[model samples]
Target: MSKILIISAVFAPEPVVSAKLSEDIANELALDYQVVVIAPKPTRPFGFDLQKDENNQTIYRLQNLDSYVFPESKLLGRLKESYSFGLACKKYISQNRKNIDLIYMNSWPIFSQYLIVKTAQKYKIKVVTHVQDVYPESLSNKIPRLSFILRFVFLPIDKFVLKNSFKIIAISNKMKTYLAKTRTLSESKIEVVQNWQNEASFTSYKQKENQDRRIFTYMYLGNIGPVAGVDLIIEAFAQASIPKSKLIIAGSGSKKEELKTFVVKSKIVNVEFLEVPDGKVPEIQGSADVMLLPIKKGAASSSIPSKLPAYMFSKKPIIGSLDIDSATAKVIVESNCGWVVEAENVAELANKMKLSFKSTKGSLLEKGENGFEYAMKNLSKKNNLSQVTNIIKNALL
Candidate 1:
């Protein structure tokens, strides 16, 4: 069998979207191709007891993410990490160049992708890039002061990665369009394939409905990083101050302690914080009356959050604090599962929270069911897996 090397920032057993997608893809591809993965040691939400092997694949677990992903710093850390991972994978590709038929890149942008694409060219290997985010632009949002410099220095590398890819898989049509317009990529080169969750896992698990009937809960789950805007959510939840309503912030990140400090200083008592252990998504999602999906003002203009599908599968109505034009906001509106408010607008988010609390149970349930139905039809893992696999397989052919 021909061999395929998968380069991903995260992989199996890591409970993030990319990890799950990469893991699923690896499993699917292993049926006919010898699969190998190069990924960081699993140190995402938390540290993992590393697994160096899989059933039908080889896993090259490099340095732990803690060594590279410096949450305390700014863009410099990301640049360094990307370069480090890029060079490491470059060395591996050079040694195994003869065996690598194709490289399915779901890794970082600019430096890492450029290095990978360059190495692929030298080895006469085909490359299919799975884009999770539009970089340089995303980086610009982070450091607006140096936006010009970031774009000037890194944008061309990003273009090279896209230009050289045999095919590009974008997670949403919005992303595909954005890449085409911004990166000047050809429409035919970019294919839309959604990031999917295994809905069957929800079927196997029973949702515990043991909450107090009088109280309304709004919950946020996932990373609390720089662009997560959890502080904004906390402040809005406090401003709403709906009697018998509470906001539960679940999951850990670099800013968790700072957020807790802010809450304590502000005397925000209606908000609660807890760490979400892995495999507890169903439990946490089931417990919430409304899911809170918040992204910073410009953080997610084209991409949908991985949690959105899982949130829908849990059958909970959503309230998204995001830009009206964003892909996530569009989904909330289109799916009829949620409401959208301008991101970073505290008063608007507060009003939305209050409205959600005052809404009738029937109205909320209807919306939740609407999202579930949409996810069933549009976000099926099997369908998306086959689409992505075919895109790669066809590219190789």
Candidate 2:
């Protein structure tokens, strides 16, 4: 069997959404290909170093300057981590260039991809790039004032990777479209492979009959960051007049403390914060009467939240606060799984929350079922992973 090297910034034992997905792909490919994974040492929220050897693959963890806890607000720390991983990856590929048959990479720590791809090109190795988000553009969205300079400096490098890669995989069609148009690449070069949920692990929870109709729970699960609009959720929840309803914000991010501070300063009584253990995600999600999906207006165009799949699996109706034309809103609307309002509109979001609070359990359950069916039909792991494997095989040919 040919040897395959997978490079990802995050992997198993890291408490991030992409880690699980990356782990699944590496393990699956190991059944046919001689697989090796090069990732950072276990750090951040979930920190447990793994044995180097696994069933059909070998994992190599490189030491880096990244903190045990993610430093979301520190640009210098992030750059140090990215560059460290990049240098390590470059050295590994340089020494093992001859043995590797194909290079598979995740698009993150942009510096790492630039280094690895450049090195791979020299070795004449075929590369398949999996794009989780469109960079420079995604970064630009967050910092509009710096966008022009960012595009000037980073766009060329982005184009080089796109133009030189054997194949490019995007997690969503919206992402593919954005990349193709911005990079001026052919649509045919990019393929869409939606993320899949582990149905076995994320089995839906049993619904409990509401003993107290007066107290409804609205929950948001996933990162609490500017892009995620946790503050928007708080602001809207605070403004809403749902006397018997409560809002629960679960998960951690760079903005988690900032959000908590805001809640305390504003004297918001209805909202509660919870630290969700990874194993308990399904349970927490299922327990909610409705799920809150909020995204900043600027970020909606380039990326879809990773939590969408889990939320779908939870079989809970979504109250999506996103741009009307965003890919996320499109999914919620098309699946008929939930309601949508314009992002960042405090009044509108508050109104939606109140409406969901008043909705009957039957109506919410029906919507949740619609979402679950959509997930099974279109986002099944078997189908999506088959697409990925087929692409890899074809690239090898």
How does each model score on TM-score?
0.94, 0.91
Clashes of each: 0, 0
Per-residue lDDT of 1-397 in model 2, one digit per residue for the tens? 8888888778766667677667777877888878787777655442222333345333432233232323464555765666677778889889989878998888354677788889899999999998877777777888889899888887788888888889999888888987889889999999899877676656545655655667798899987766888898888988996888889998877788888888899899988888877567887776688899999877866556777767887888998998898877888999999899998898999998888877787998999999888887777676677788778778887
**Residue by residue across 164-241, what tens digits does model 1's lDDT show?**
898999989999998899889899999998888888777577887737977889999887788889989898998888
- Return the lDDT, model 1, position 275: 76
- Give model 2's clash tally: 0
> Which pairs clash (backbone N, Cα, C closer than 3 Å) in model 1?
none
Query: All models: lDDT?
Result: 0.84, 0.78
Worst 10 residues of 1 by lDDT: 58-67
lDDT of 1 at 182: 82
User: Which ten-residue region of model 2 has the weakest summed lDDT?
Assistant: 60-69
Give the C-alpha miss distance for residue 384 in model 1, angstroms. Answer: 1.0
